[model samples]
Target: MNIILAIILLVILPYVGFWKLFEKAGRPGWEGIVPLYNAYVMIKLCGRPTWWFILVLIPGLNILVFIGILVDFVKSYGKFSLLDHILAVALPFIYLPKWGFDKNTKYIGASATAPFREKYKIALKKTATREWADAIIFAVIAATLIRTLFIEAYVIPSASMESSLLIGDYLFVSKVNYGARLPMTPVAFPFAHHTMPLIGTKAYWDGVELPYYRLPGLSDIKKGDVVVFNYPMDADSPLYRPVDKRENYIKRCQGTPGDTLSVVDAQVFINGKAAPTPPHGEMSYTVQSDGSEINPQLINDLHLEDLAPGINNTFTVNTTLASVNALKGYSNIKSIVPTLSPKGMEDPLYPVYPVKFPNYKITPNFPKFTWNLDNYGPIIVPKKGWTVKLDSLTFPVYGRAIEIYEGNKVQVQGTDILINGKKADSYTFKMNYYFMMGDNRHNSEDSRFWGFVPEDHIVGKALFIWMSMDDNASFLNKIRWSRLFNIIH
Candidate 1:
């Protein structure tokens, strides 16, 4: 259906407009019907370099080239109004056919005015308000196009990625890294994400939703990459959000498709081997210091935060490896060890499939598998086309993926598993899934609290920190000079 529409818009409509416009410009009307050659002829008519046709092959760059061609083409017809240029680029089918078929519209050629702006000087100089409105409108359109299809600015709002990314850090997320997702909900308030600020109302309307689609990207996601994705569970809220409009979250990709992920004593393991941790990844530690208190300057120098005094000269701190190692050098500090949950401790953890879907339960043979934030999974991340045998015990692990994420009605009747009302023992995944965790292990409520991140929920890759400010610091000291323009690893 979409393919047919594209053909009509890009080929049929353009062919019709170009055919009439070509006759007005004294070019052979049939040349406008030729696919690639039509663009070449149009470029030639506009007095642009013929080599620009090469740029039209590139995705994002092609939009700019087409806009330039259309603007010049309209100018060739002596239509120099800002509205004319907008219509030439936005609705060339309507603008071109009207100008070409209408007897009054004449081809003034390129030398009518030295500058395009000079041709509309009288009308443009008439009102400052009109000029300001045109500038703002053009600026919004250009910025919106660039932001939706290329790169967008984002700011860290939570300490989830602390130590690697801090609160108040401004980042540029690259859409081309994992491919830019076409907006599922296209109509929305300008520059607002999820909700409109202050008003706390939805920024977008659910009407006219499009299917999930992505353009070609530079590369696929790799392990240890800091990725931004929409919160998958946000749809569970009372006021549902479209896939792309869910809360944006940034975390490190710990497990890719098909990899089994687990955490033992707060240490992540993938496929039975220990996964590589980020250099600045951190965890909460219980530090036992001597009766004498540690100097506030030393604590400040180590960049430690959330320092809480524990009983008997013990202190709990969330810090990076370098800071932990530096603290260990002090003879007064007895030990610094990870704050691990006791083994066999089964408190509520992620997915909570059994609770969410009461029909499913752990098989007696599995010894009621207990998991915690510190000691989690061994669960396999679902891969596209991978089939898994479903049973009582395995259901809790993959139930959400099969039912909610994959959009299937799943249930357990007696000992048999029913998917979409069919008695099936196995199911194949439709899309690849990822497991994301923050660098601040204990502090982050990440995949361990939720399940896998579906492919459609992916947003972009965090490229770099353009600015960093400390919220707690004075105005003069707020800017973090060293972190400015720092590349996000």
Candidate 2:
């Protein structure tokens, strides 16, 4: 049976059973299925204002609403006190039905709450063990609903976004924040968010089954919001790392759609104006023997084989900062090949190091390459209805279309794609890519590395930080009082 249908059966069966029991007590039987109307019937049975339901919507105070109802239920049955309160709350199904159907007690027009202390007291009551046993299951359902549809817990991992979000920061991620994605994978394991038996399976790709369609969340991605998303390479894989077990990273949005973005002298310029940066953060650069290059520090170790001694040069690198910094005092700037330390060397199996250089001069105040993080494109992002054709003439304008080879045989082409020899029409297009970067310029592996991050890979914008901690030096570091309550720009 479908799990939702099973849950409906489990819930409605008892309410119907209680309705029949209410009929035996000379009350309206239809009250059982009317939701809040049933609450009104119980209120009338216990003698209280029906307007009290309004109090149930207040945060934190709603616990008192249920507790007050349970107290009233016990009192209606001529039962009161702490132990009765426990049964009314901890095992409410037994007490609610007992008060409704117990023939031994005659209906007295008893007030549930009297102004004095005596009126609020709960009386002792006894009911069947069956209701007591079902308490755990019912409570589980209530808790599960709140977690699945309202809010959930997530832990933050990595320092991609330091200062704002830290490693080991626990967060209450709202599932409803982006209205719920239909639960396509129904049998998820408890607390893990992984589907059991069919673990690692995805709903659909490109446009297959596409089992889930989520309603839009709070708002679209805003600049500077920390967001968590599925890695573009593989959506089926969990975002969290096992060691931290939160989504893999928390990064600030540096660019949004339709923005003409460029980085000049380590200061990001959006549409020909300098972007405001945080008061305190580092501006990273690529340094040569002569001077420094101002740019977004490329944190990925890139070793393309075109510019080294070996016929096949491969870069096993830690990061790649472009030499795009203009010499502030000098008109002409130049870069010599950098000498690597012992630790910077790579082995034959994993041939890293000695980055290949193109025959291009390092010029001051000029955009170096077409798509470095700091010197990226004038290419406008394609929105819906924008058509694209992949031919040699138009391919370069979109992006480079190069064929990668394995053992002198072409395996893949530009934009991480391949052309099948047998079928010339087998070329496939991937999703549209967007540029993403970190606020902390020196440290971030973003669109600059493996190319642009697809727009579909965007999760949601990071909202406000409810809490903050200083975990840089030690666990006991003092809180950053200045940063507290500060809005993420």
Candidate 3:
């Protein structure tokens, strides 16, 4: 409704202002009411060639051309002040009506001899401060629009996707791949994610929240695509954040909507078939070595992260496939084996069943389901309009989705489930959900730790690494030259 009102004001106010302006310029006042023809009249008023009309139809380029036209339009009225030009571009509806209807303002004929730079200089000479302010305001508006709708730069802060995406790697995420989500929390500090940078307070207000909506994009999110999204469980904290304002997380999409996902012996399977893994995916392994301590040079050469020393000189290391293969060729290494969680053994898992409220105690029946990180279920990812029976066994899996993510008051009564105080035998999911896991499989705190990520939380697709840096390296060696500008898989 707010968006509709905004659009109406934008259209009606400009139309009325332009209609009056048309009369002052000796053109028919009704011409402004006619949609595309008004633009043609506007182009003629700016003294530009008719071919320039086609340039205004383009997206990004049109903004510059339109701004130029508006500047010239204001100058054509003999108002050459920097403030007037800024107001014309930034608040066109308000300024246009003022300039058009006010008896004092007059239309000075377009100066064909004066160059654009000379006219801009005449307008800006006395109002340097206003000119600078206008430039900053326009730059911020343009950057925010591009960031929200097209592509955004992101920095990797954790080692969860190590080997593939290193700490301090700067990425350009493409919103066009998975579609750009409209701002749910519209009022936020520009460039700040969840919290204020220096003060560390909440960066956005929930006063004017909007429903989740996305603009159509180039493609749908497919399996194996690296994705960035808001952390679903971040809202469990005392300071609640809206969907778009929650902490951002980057991970590989392991399961798509409607897919049944499971992990057996640390291997993922989607719909009864072994899922394809990323070429650079990694996991932890226990490596037994001779009594002597391993050489630090060898560790550096293989780019291995030594987790900790195990019993009898065995070291648990987080390493990539190439590092593991290189370590296997050493004679002194006794054995190397993957650290896999045993089946039929229950461990702390996500979406802890029957825990209705946030930060509540785990129900006693949670142990009935024997699922671990490595040996998870053939559980289904929720799809829009897909129905699933609500039972004790399935309640734990979908409870968070139904109650928290989808916004309902869900309760499990004796052999019955109630949503919003009414009995519900099944639930047709309102939004699709995705399963996300990091490329560094064993070390990641991802979907396995929390739960499924709803479509509303998705941000964009990882596009490329514009810059990469290693903090642990010396100053001269910090920048990773090879990874710079590399396309993200």
TM-scores, in order shown?
Answer: 0.80, 0.44, 0.80
Q: Backbone clashes in each candidate structure, one number apiece?
A: 0, 14, 0
Q: What overall lDDT, based on C-alpha atoms, would model 3 receive against the true structure?
A: 0.80
Sort every candidate by TM-score, greatest first.
1, 3, 2
Model 2 ranges off by over 4 Å: 1-153, 168-184, 194-210, 236-248, 258-275, 278-281, 285-370, 392-434, 451-458, 467-487
Write candidate 1's Cα lDDT for 209-263 as tens digits.
6667899899999889999999987877685777888999999999999998888
TM-score of 2: 0.44
Name the candidate, 1 or 2, with the larger TM-score value: 1
Q: Residue 47 CA error for candidate 2 (Å)?
A: 20
- In candidate 1, the residue pairs with backbone N, CA or C atoms under 3 Å apart (3 or more residues apart, or in different chains) clash, namely none
lDDT: worst 10-residue window of model 2: 401-410
lDDT against the true structure, each candidate: 0.80, 0.44, 0.80
Model 1, CA-based lDDT: 0.80
